[model samples]
Target: MKKVITLTLPGELIFTRLAAQTAASVAALVCGECHPKDNNCEFINAFELAVSEAFTNSALHACQDELPPVTLTFIAERHQLTVTVRDTNEPFGIETPQPDIESYPEGGYGLLIIRKVMDTVTYRRDGDANIISMSKKL
Candidate 1:
């Protein structure tokens, strides 16, 4: 069976923090729903981190100046967790940072972290919206 939760977040600081809080909540639910015996410490932490980074990126980059609302959707199934964050803003092209800069960089590292944590990071452009889909196996 699959469980889904969708949340609409305002393009504001308070709502931004709420997004991270929401990610943690979902992680807890998934950990309990999937494997109560094992809390999935590592995977749970990674999911929380990646979700926070991705949401922050969308609220900051994609919705820049426009203050467009961001939609965060969490889907948990038998053995996988899929987080879909969509924003009705221009898609900002992102490229992996250079190997040298990737190490000691203070910025432009969110996508790198997302790639490392999530099993798959997919991007789709729908008209003027950018949809970022991140998945991790439970």
Candidate 2:
């Protein structure tokens, strides 16, 4: 069976924790359905981290003045989970240069971490909305 979950949140840093928790909860449900026995699955952690990073990036970089609305959609299948985050703010391209880990920069590692953890990551502009889609195999 396939399950779909959707969440709409304010595009503000204050709601980042809420976004993370929501993603984690859905990920846990999906992981449990996919892997019945293993409670401490790594996929849950990866999903939480990737979703949180995406949410934070949208909240910080996408909005200008009043925060917009961020939409998160999760599609859970038998063996894979796909997440899409959409924001109405200006579409800032996601082509960020790989940050040098050796330097340990204080910021700019969100995209890097997201790409590293998620099996597939993509960004596109749909009219006025910026959509980031990430997928991971469970």
Candidate 3:
């Protein structure tokens, strides 16, 4: 059987702390899933970073208005961590990066980091919610 753990945090700055917490949570769960094996430090660190970026992205771009609420969920399995961040904000897509890697600005690197840390990144619209899904493999 597959095990699932769900967490719902408010659409506020405080939830930023939860990013690290969620990372550790996923790490532990992944450890359990892969018991008798060493902890996957790289996978855990990447998941944590991706989760932090996704949460910060929602806080910065999505919940700008006095909207309802934002939520983040993590689904961990044997060798993967799938995260879904839901928000009720304007659906915006990531802008294309500069062709010249060196020409890229110092900022606007959040998605870059997320893409590097996550094996897959996807965005979708569910009703009034914009859902961002990021996954990392162990």
The numbered model that scores best in lDDT is 2
How many backbone clashes does every candidate have?
Answer: 0, 0, 0
Which residue segments of model 1 deviate by more than 4 Å? 33-40, 62-66, 98-103
| lDDT per residue (tens digit) for residues 16-134 in model 2 | 88887777777778777544234466787787788899999889875477788899999999998899999988777778999888998888888889999899999999999999999
Worst 10 residues of 1 by lDDT: 33-42
Which tens-of-lDDT digit does each residue in 9-119 have in candidate 3? 666667866865676566656755432223466666676677787777777764555634667777777777788888887787855473456775666778888888788
State the C-alpha lDDT per candidate: 0.77, 0.85, 0.71
Off by over 4 Å in 3: 32-40, 63-67, 98-104
Q: What TM-score would every model get versus the actual structure?
A: 0.83, 0.89, 0.80
**Local accuracy of candidate 1 as per-residue lDDT tens digits, 63-125:** 456688889999998788888888887676656664467467677778888888889999888
Q: Report the C-alpha displacement of residue 13, candidate 1, in angstroms.
A: 3.5
Output the number of the TM-score-best candidate. Answer: 2
